[model samples]
Target: MVSPLTVVKSEGPKLVPFFKATCVYFVLWLPSSNPTWFSALIKCLPIFCLCLFLLAHGLGFLQTHPSATRIFVGLIFSAVGDAFLIWQDQGYFVHGLLMFAVTHMFYASAFGMKPLDLRKGLVIAVLSGSSYALLYPCLSGAFTYLVGVYVAIISFMGWRALAGLQLIGAAWRWTKLAAGSGALLFILSDMTIALNKFCFPVPHSRAIIMSTYYAAQMLITLSAVESREPVEAYGLSKTN
Candidate 1:
């Protein structure tokens, strides 16, 4: 069988698609005011490219890392959410939010649950609770509960990410760090969206949100690739 390092080296250059897709979104789609089909396609390109990059490893990748397939699902949902959000003026806000909520759930599943690290849970609870308090006055109607659920789901995702990763060595440490940072960045991007939408306008929010979000997804994807070499660190033997 081929080694993990060989796979990574062979796949590294395939990242070109991911970069080009990201560049297209930030440059051509983000600046445009019009919400056309073309713009929607551009918006979801990065995630689609991410999925492609993962699929490049073939189905065998799943055996290498238990979360590989779930991560792919999460990326797909993220892409859908991105496209739906582009039509927010047409009342697709709830759809977008729901899609992303599902996305987070898949991500949490990918992270798995074990050790039940209450410390991480407590920190996430505080952050989520504080964020909810700040956004409380702004939430109303169906969103009152809707946003609350979304916050809870994302918080759980964050906690799972923090608790799930382990830094046993240099390679494992980088993978763990990337996954953890991705989770935090995901939360930060959402916070920026919440502040800009439900509260006062955030300066440069559009760029901040999209940039952080892309960075978050990219980091998470890379972590999965990095984890393949040492699947033992991920505690897959316990689950599978």
Candidate 2:
């Protein structure tokens, strides 16, 4: 029988080319401010691959925890959001936002199953509230209300992720941290999107926003895998 360790070692090298291809496609897609169908398809390939990667890892972790399935579902929603947003000119912005809102819900549900620190959750809530206060003046009408709702949900997701950082297992520590950081970055990326779309035009905002968004998704996916590792191997217990 093939050892899990050996399988991991063998599979590790395959990711290098996948990552390289994603980078190449992203770079090519970046030059066209408004890309043609072919260019848009190329741009979407990286996100599609990233979603596949997340799904694969999430499925692999399913034996360890049912929460892993939530991660997979979240990634699927994220991929749909990516597809919608890629064609923003076709009136898909609202659709993309709704998809992502659902994505955050799944992610939040997954993280919420873990132990949380109430104090940290409170701190994150305050921060998110402050951010919304700053952005509210720039928005108006129905868009304002929609954005506000999105902010609230995504903020709650981030808070749950941050609270997970205090979880007491060593094997889960890095995973929790990565997931928390990813949640924060996801908020940052969405905030940037709101600012660029409603408040002001940020220079090179597409590159900045997509880079953070991709990194956030990747990190969250990695955390799902990391979260499945055995705590005993790291000489730690689940209790604080």
Candidate 3:
């Protein structure tokens, strides 16, 4: 895909709300042991803001770049996942995992599987497969297949992102970098979660997970805005 360098940056003001919501979660919610049920709203605020940001950026992309639209929908699913996760100790882990699995499917669909380089896909698959193996002993019988399936989907998502990152002409473009980095960071975030819950406790796991997760989402959101168009491109009319 082309870089579409003309619209490389998203509107900075639109990100303020997302950052503010993240700060509130990290500062007030993450540290609180007695967080109220209503705090689930705070947990989802950043994702909600991101969905609004994508909509506010514009909808014209849906005509030519359905990928951006898919990511927007993915973010909405992520928000639901976040809500379910807050109650994980109450048996919502599986529900939350299901939502996030759907989120990865949307992201993988948005990333596309074109230029399917076996080398790249294989590398990602090996990494994800090894990770699942590492966690195999800790996984409960009920969730063994579920977690395995989730890992496979996310690994495929990363493979698709990696393939796009090496677009013949736009190898070094910000769109590629953003999407690729976002996918990697997303993998790291989920891996951290698995280690914390299934394998062993990670130091400050919640903070690390949230920080990387939000940053990954932010980068992915920016990529959608950059890859899609604005009102026009040079002398070429997008409406054409």
What range of 10 consecutive residues in model 3 has the weakest lDDT sum?
227-236
TM-score of 3: 0.87
Superior candidate under TM-score, 2 versus 3? 3
Best by TM-score: 3
Model 1 score (lDDT): 0.84
Residues 1-240, model 3: lDDT tens digits: 443544434367788899999998878755335545678888888999988888786676554567788898899899889888888887888898999889889988877777678899889988998999998999988889999999998898888877867535535666667788999999999999999999899998988898899999988887776553333432445452
Write the residue-wise lDDT of candidate 1 on 43-84 in tens digits.
Answer: 888899989888887777867677777888999999889888
How far off is residue 92 in model 3, in Å? 0.6
lDDT of 2 by residue, 83-201 (tens): 77777777888999999999999989878645666777778778878877888989888777898899889988898777767445444466677788899889989989988988899
Question: What TM-score does each of the candidates earn?
Answer: 0.86, 0.80, 0.87
Residue 145, candidate 1: Cα error in Å is: 0.8
Model 1 RMSD in angstroms? 4.4
Candidate 3, after superposition: displacement of residue 16 in Å?
Answer: 1.5
Model 3: how large is the Cα RMSD against the reference? 4.2
lDDT of 1 at 195: 88
Q: Clashing residue pairs in candidate 3, if any?
A: none
- lDDT accuracy of residue 183 in candidate 2: 93
RMSD of each: 4.4, 6.4, 4.2
